[model samples]
Target: MLQIPSWKRILILAVCLFGIVSAAPNLFYGRVEAHNDAIAAAEKAGFETEAQAAARAAWPDWLPSGLVNLGLDLRGGAHLLAEVQLADVYKARMDALWPELRKALADERATVGAVRRAPSDPGVLRVQIGEPAAMTRALEIAASLATPVVSLTGIGQNDLAISAEGDQIVVTLSEAEKLATDNRTMQQSLEIIRRRVDEVGTREPTIQRQGSDRILIQVPGIGSAEELKALIGTTAQLGFHPVIARGSATGTVPGIGQVIYPSVEEKGLNYTLDAVPVVTGEELTDARPDFDQNGRPAVSFRFNPAGARKFGDYTAANIGQLFAIVLDAEVISAPVIQSHIPGGSGIITGNFTVESSTNLAVLLRAGALPAKMTFLEERTIGPELGQDSIDAGSVAALVGMAAVVFFMIASYGLFGVFATVALGINMALIFGVLSAIGGTLTLPGIAGIVLTIGMAVDANVLVFERIREELRTARGPARAIELGYQKAMSAIVDANITTFITATILFLAGSGPVRGFAVTLTVGIITSVFTAIYVTRLMLVFWFERRRPKTITV
Candidate 1:
C-alpha cells in the first residue's frame, strides 16, 4: 500500500513511458543499416571521419535535426529583436507617388524640381524642389499618391523642401494620418514576413509583433540562422512583360499600354510585341517547388479565381508571342505561348538543385518581409560546448536529487523515504512532458526544474506535519493518514497557485530563453502538485490499509 495505488502509480508511470517511447525511434535508427549507407556516403565525400559520419547519419527523425542539443546560449546561436524601418516603407510609397505627382504636376513645363535617382542607393529617388510656388506642382500630384500624406514645415519659406519633415522638407503627418498609415504599414510588414517565412519553410517558427514595430522570431530546428537572415533581408521586386512582335517592332513602340520584356540586355531593348502578362506575380496565391513530368526542377504557382480569369484572357489575346518571367526585375525564362491557360495553376521551369528547390519553396511560402531586419545579436555553439553543458546540467540535477532524497528520508523516517521516491517520479514527469511537447530545456529551465524539486516535496511535508499533529492527539494510523491529506490539500493548492501566477508573468515579460524558463517552471509546478498531493497520498493510504496500526508515528 505504501507504493501508490495502481491508478496514481500508473498516472505517473505513463509520462515516463511516453518520454522513453519518443526517444526510442531515434535510438533504433542509430543501429539501422540505412543509416550505415548514409554514413558510407558521408565518409566517401570527405565531409566526416568514419566515426563522425556514423554518428551523424545515425540520427533518426525523432532526434533533433541540427546542432541545438544544449540549446541557444550554450551552443552559440542568434537571438534578434528587430523593428521594421517604417521610414523606408514610407519612402517606397512616396517614390511610387512621385510618378503620379509628376504626372499630376506635369503642367506643360515638366518644370519638375531637379529629379534624379536617390544618391544613397539606386532603389529610391530624391527630388529637390525650388521655391514654395514650385513645390506646388508636387502638391498638385500629391492626391495621386493614394496613401496617407504628411505636410512639410522646414521649407526655406522662399525655398520649399520636398524632402524635409516638420520644419524641414519632410514634415510631420496629421495625427489621424500617422495612426492610419502606421497601422497599415505594420500589418503589411507582418504579412510580408509571414509569407516570406512560409516560403522559406520554417516548420514551426514563431513570428509575432511586439508593440508597434518590433518582430520576434523563434525557429526551433533552424541550422543556418544566417540563411534565414539573408532571405528575410531581401526585398524582391518581380515583373513580366510581352516580347515585341517581329512585324510591329520596326522603330515603333508596339507595346503602348503593354510593358514588353524585349530580347535586349536592358529595359530599352526592342523586338517585343508578343503580348501582355495575364497576371503579375503579385496575384500569386500560393507557390511551391515541384518537378515536371521528366522530373525537371521547377516552381509551381496557383492563382486565385480572379487571377486565373485574367491570365486566361491575356493568353487568349496573345496566343502566338513570347512572355518573359522576370524575378527581381531580371528575365529568368521566356516561354513561348502555344495555347491559352484558363486554369490558374502552372509551374515555373528553371535550372535548380534539390537544396535550391527547398530554399525557394521556403521563400515562396513565407512570402516577403515588409522590410529587412539586421541581426543585433548572433551566437552559434559547437557540439563540444553543448555536450559539456549537458554533462554539467546532468551532474547538477543528480546532486540536487540526491540531496532531496536524503532530506526526505531523514525528516519523516520511513514515510519521508516514500515521499522522496515519489519526488523522483515527479521529476521524471516534468522531463517527460517537456520532451513530448518539443520544449527546449534552457539553463534557466534547468533552474526551474531544480526549484521544482523542492516544490514537489512541499505537499508531502505539509501532509506529514498534519499527520504528526493528529497523532499527538492519539489518532489511529488510518484516520491520521486520511485527515492529513484532506487538511493539507488547501495549503498545497494555494502555494502552487501563487507560483503559477509568477510563472505566467515571466513568460510574458521576458524574451527568448527567459520565457523558456517560465514555461518549464509552470509545467513543473503543475506536475509537482499532482505528484505531491495525489501520488503521495495514494501511497500513504495503501500503506495504512495494509498495516492497520493502532498508533501512528513518523
Candidate 2:
C-alpha cells in the first residue's frame, strides 16, 4: 500500500474531530436553532462578543418550537385526508340569482304561477317557473342575478341551465357545471391548505391538491391535524342580507344550519313576505379587522363599485330596516340600518374578543373557502408520542453503532479500530448533510441510517479482511497491505453501488415516510464509501511509512 505521511494522517484526524465536535451543537438545537428571540434580541442589541454569539448559537431548544420540528412517524404526528364539497359554489350561484329572478317576475308581474327552486344534482340547482310564456325576459333577468358569472343556458328548447356549474344557474350543474366545479374545488382546496400551513408556522409545508377534489397536506412538526381540519373545513361564508322583516318568535331559517343568535322565539308571524334582503355579502371586495370610530372592535369592508351601487339602491329603497350579516347561513349579527351607505364601504361592529376578531379577519382575508370541506380521514399524533419516538430511534441508533464498533475491533484488532474511527466520521457527515439539506428524519430514515451505519463498517472490514488474506501469503507487511486494497477495491465498489441502487428504488417507488428513509440511507451509503476508502487507506499508508513493521499481524 502507498504509505501516507504521519503529518497528513494527523491533518485528516484533526479535520474529522473538528467536524464531529462542530456537529455537536446541531445534535441539540439543530431542530429548533435555540432561543430564537433571545438570539435575535442579542444580535439587534449589537452583542457581537464571541461569548455572546456562541451562547446564542449553542443555546439548545430544550423545548422545541413549532418551527424546525419533526413530524409524526419521525417525531410522531397524524396524517389526514380531506375532501372539499364541490356543491356549495353551485348553491352560492343559485342564491345570488334569486334576486334577479324576483325582479324580472315582479317587473312584468309575469310569475302569477309559482317561484320554485329545483335541482338536478346536489351541486346543480335549477330554478323553474310555471313554463313562462315569455322565457326570454326571464332568462335575461336571471342572467344578471350575480356577478362573476355569465347567463344560463338550457337543456330543452326554452328552459335555461347555468352554462357551467359555476355560472348563475338553473341547477343540477349541466355537463358544463361538473367540469367547472371540479376545477374550482381543487384550486380552492389547495389555497385553504396553503393558508392552514402558514398558520401552523412551519418552515416549508408540503401541500398537494390531488385529483379533482382531494387535497394532501404535509406539515412537518405539526401533528395537530384535527385543529387544522377544523380551521379548513369551515366554509366561513360571510354574507350581509337585509332582514326585510323579523319573524315574531322566529325559530330558525329553513334549510339553513342552526346556530344561536340573539333572537326572540315568541311566536306571532312565522314568516313575512316583506322580509327580503336589500344587500348581500358578494359585493364585498376586502375585509379587515379594525377598530370602529367609536373604539369598538369591528370588521371593516370595501365593496366593488357595482356592490356600492346595489347597496345604495337597497338602502334607499328600504330605510330604517335590520340588515343581517350572516355567516354560513347563520345570523352572526343583525342591526337596524340608520341611513344609506353609498361609498361601498362599511364596518360591522360587534362584541368580539381579540381572538375572535383576529380569526374572523383571517377567514375573510383567506376568502372563506368556496365550499365546506369534510375530513374523510384524520390522524392526530401528540407531542409526547413524537418525543418517545425520537428516544427510541436514538437508542436503536446508538446500539447499532456500538455493535459495528465492537465488530470492527474484534475482527481487525488495531486496524479494525482505524476503520471504526473512519466509520464514526462517516456518520457525523451524514448528520451534517441531513441538517444542511433540511431533510425530514422520518422513522424509515432512522432505519436507513442504522442500516448504513452497519454497512459502513463493511468497507473497512472488506479491506482489513483482504489484507489478512494477503498477509497469509505475502513476504512483507508493505506488500500485503498494498495487495489487500488493490484486491478489495473492486468488491467495495460493486457492493456499495448495488446497495445504492436498492436505496434508489425505495426512494422512488416507496410512498410517504418510506421515501424519507430511502433518501437518508442513500446519502449515508455514498458518504460511507468515501470515508472507508480514503480514511482507512490513509491510516494504513501512514502506519507502513513510519512503523515499517517487519511482519504484519493486524
Candidate 3:
C-alpha cells in the first residue's frame, strides 16, 4: 500500500552517499588542513617543493576538501572590543573646514570685514568678524559651503549646521551628517583592520562592527591581545605638512590652524606645522619597505596622479622650506626641499628598524583608519583551553550518541535500529552542509549537534506509534504502514517548523556563538526531517520486502 517512486528512492540514496563523501574529509581534519595550507603557500610563492608535493598526494584533488571552520573560541584567539573616537573625525572635519571658510570670508572682505578664527571646542569652528554688523554676511558665506547630505534618511538636510552667535559664526556637522559620518568611519575602520589582520595571514579572523561606535575583533592563533592591539592600534595617518617652526620646548603654543608634533628620531625636539596637509596618505598608490640612500631602513611610497601633481606643484614653489612628515600626529622627519619633486615618489626615512619599516609599509598599503579607537575590553584565549573544550565536546558527543542509539534499539527492536541508522545519516548531512557552506563551528555548535542526535528519532517514534494505532484498525501490514506515515506527517511538520523558526530568530538577532548554535541547529533540523521520513522508511521497506511476512512486529 505504501510505495516510493524509483526516482525518489534513487535521489535519496544519492543524497545520502554525497553527504558521506562530503563529510569524510573532516574525519582527517589535520591532514586535510595541512594539505590545503601547503597548496595555498606554494601557489603564493609561485614554486613547489617535495614536501608540498607530498602534501598534495595526501588527499586527492578531485574529492571535496571543504571542512568546517573552527570559531575563535574553539581555535584559541585574541578578542578585542574597541570604541571608535567618532568625535575626533568631527573635530577633524571642522578643522579642515576652517581654512576654506576663512578663504571664502576673506574673498568677501568688503562685506564681512576682517575674519579671524576664534577659540572654540573640538568639532566647533567659530569665526569672529571685526565688524559686528558683518556677522550676517559671514554666516551666508559659511552656509554656501554646506552641501546636502547624500543619504536617504538625511534627504533635504545640509551637511553642516551653521549659526550666528553674537558677532561669531559657529559651524558644526549637522545631526544627519554626523550619523552618516559615524557609520562611514566605523565601516572604514573595520575594513582597514581586516586588511591589516589578513596581511599577517593568521587564518580566518572575525572583524565586525558592534554598536554605533564599537568594533569586535577575534583572531585565532594570535599570541595575545597586546600583539593584536599593537598591529592595528597605529592610526597610520601619514601627512606632509609645511613646517612652521622648530623648537625644544613642549609648552610652546601653536598659532591658530597649527599643531605641534614631537620628532620620532630626536629626543626633546619638536616641530610646529600647518593643520592641513599638502598631501595625505589617502592618495598613495603603493608603499614598500626599502633602504634609503644612506642605507638605512625606510618606507618608499608612490602617489596617484592627482596627488603627484599637487606634490610637484607645492614642492616647486616651496623649494627651500622644510616639510614635516607626520605619522599618527608625530613628525618623523622635517626635510628641507632641495629640488622640485615630481612623479609623486618619496622615501620616509626615520630611525626605523627593519621590522618597523616593514610594518609601516604594510599599514600604508592597507590605507589609514578614518578615526582613532580606544580598546574597552581585551581577551586572549589559550590553545590549551580550546583543546580541552574540544576534548570535552567530543566525549560528550560520543556519550550522548551512544546513549541515544542504545535507547532507540531497546525501545522498538528492529525498528529502533532503522531509526538509529537514519540518525547517523542525519549527522553526516549536517556536517556535510556545514562544510559546503563554510560555516564556523563553535563550542555551542557542538552542543547543538549532540542535542540533535537525541532529537532525531522523535519523528520516527511518532511514525512507529502511529503504525501501532493503525494496526488495530487496518486489515494488512502495508495498509497500516501507509496510514501511519500519512497521519504522522502533520505533527512532524508542525514540530520541526516551530523549532526551525526559533533557530532562524537566533541566527538573525544573535551574534558570535549564538549564531553558530543557530546554524548547527537549523542544519540539523533539515537533515533529521529527511533521514527520519525518507531514509528510515526506505530501510524498513527493504527489510519488509526481504521477509515477505503476513504480519510484522514494529
Candidate 4:
C-alpha cells in the first residue's frame, strides 16, 4: 500500500544527487569563481598561464560549475539612473537635414524663387521662399523629402511632418517617427552601455532601460559611482571630415557648412572641416590598441565593406589633400593624403598614454551612444555595508532554522528529524536551481530562504498529523502511513499552488529586490514540496522497513 514505483524512486534519487552536486561549488565560492575567470581569460588570450592552468585544475570541467550571481544589494556596487536627452537628438537630426533640404530646394529655385534657411525652434527646420504663390509646388517637393518610417510601430507613417505657413515651409519629425526614434535611442543606449561595461570585464553588471528615456545601471565590485559613470559617459563620436582650412588664432571661426575644432595634441590650433563626415565610427568593424611606426601609442581601426569602398574612392581622388580625424568634435589628427589608402584601415595617433589608447580602442569597439545622457541619480553601496547585511541575514537564518528544528523534534520525534533532513535537501535544490538559471540573489532573497526553512515542513506536518489520526482506525501501520500521504496530498497541493501563483504575480509585477524575493520564494515552493512529500516519505519507508515496527510513532 505504501509502495513507490521503481522508476519514480530512481527519478527522485537522481534529482537529489543532481542538486547536491550542482550546489557543491557554492561551498568553495572563491575557488570556483577563480576557476571560471581563469577559463574565460585563457580562452580570450588564446593561451593559458601557469596560474590559470592551476586554477582550472582546481575545479574540474566535468562537474556542475554554475554559481548564483550576487545582486548589487548584496555585493555592494555603484548605481546610476541616467536620462537620455531626446531633444538633443532631435536638434541634431534637424541640423543634419539643413544641407540636404537646401540642395533639394535650390534644384528648383527657378520655380520657387531663392530659398533661404529661416530661424525657428531647436528641432524645427524652416525655409523661406521668395514667391508665396508657388508655395503649393514647393510643398509637394518638401513632402517628397519625408520618407516612410522603417520601424514596425511606425509603418505607413512618414518620418517628417511637412507644412507650409505663408512663405515659410516647416519640417519636423512626425509623432510616429519620434516614437520610433525614442525606442531606437533607448535600445542603442542600452546596448552601448552593456558593451562598455562588458569591455571592463565586470561580473554580472545590471544595465537595463528603466522607462522611455531613463537607464538604470548597477555594477558590483566597482569602486564608486564616478568610476562607473566615467566608463559610460563618453559619447566617443569618431568621424573623418575633409579639412577646409587651418588656423592658430584664438578668434578663428568656421564658414557655413563647416565646423572648427581645436586640436587634441596642440591647444589653440584649430582645423576647419566639413560638418558632414565621409565615414563615422558606426562603420568600424574592429578597433584595437597598437603602436605606430614612430612607437607612439595609437588605435588601429578597420571599416566595413561599404565604408571601405567609400573611403578608398575618396582617398584615390583626394591625394595630397588634408582630411581631419575628429573625436567628439575635436580634431585628433589632420594628415595629408600622400597616397591612395585602400582597404579602409587607418591609425589614430595622438599624445596618448598606454591606458588612454586602450580606452579609446574600447570606446570605438563599443560604438557611440545615440544621444547625450544626464545622470539624475547616483549611489555607491560599500562592501562593508554589504558584509554587515550578509552577517545579519546569516544570523537570522541560523536562528530561525534552529527554532524550526527544535519545534519539529519536540512535536514529532523521529518523524520531525526526517522533515528537517528533507528541509536541508530542499535548500540545496533551491541553490542548485538558482545557479542553473543564473539568478541573482539579493538580501530579500536571503530572507525568502529563511522563511522557506521555517515553512518547508508544512506538508510533513500534515502527513504526520494524519498518520496519528489514522493509527486509531487503520488495519496496519503501512495502511495508516499510505492513507496519511493520500489524505494530505489535496491540501498540500492546493496550498502550494496558490502560493506559487502569488509568487509568480509578484515576479511579473515587481522590480529589483522584490523580483529577487519572488524568485527565491517560487523556487523554494517547488523544492520544499518535492522534499517534504517525496524525500521524507522515502526516508520514513526505509526506517519502517528496516525496523518492521508494529506501530510507528509520529
lDDT of 4 by residue, 454-519 (tens): 779988999999999999885589999999999999999999999899999999999888888999
Residue clash pairs of candidate 4: none
lDDT of 2 by residue, 191-249 (tens): 76687567545544557666677776666565487766666666667666655455555
- Give each model a TM-score: 0.69, 0.70, 0.89, 0.93
Rank by lDDT, highest first: 3, 4, 2, 1
Against the unseen true structure, what C-alpha lDDT does each candidate score?
Answer: 0.62, 0.66, 0.91, 0.90
Query: What is the alpha-carbon lDDT for the whole of candidate 1?
Result: 0.62
List runs of model 3 lying over 4 Å from the truth: 1-7, 44-62, 165-167, 202-204, 247-251, 265-269, 285-309, 333-355, 473-475
Q: After superposition, how far is residue 492 of candidate 2 from its true place, in Å?
A: 3.9
- Report the CA-based lDDT of candidate 3 relative to the real structure: 0.91
Question: Ten residues in a row with the worst lDDT in model 1?
Answer: 153-162
Identify the leading candidate in terms of lDDT: 3
Judged by TM-score relative to the true structure, which candidate is superior, 2 or 3?
3
Q: What is the model-wide C-alpha lDDT for candidate 4?
A: 0.90
Number of residue pairs clashing in candidate 4, backbone atoms closer than 3 angstroms, sequence gap of 3 or more or interchain: 0
Off by over 4 Å in 4: 5-7, 49-63, 113-121, 128-133, 151-156, 165-168
How far is 451's C-alpha from truth in model 2 (Å)? 1.1
Better of 2 and 3 by lDDT: 3
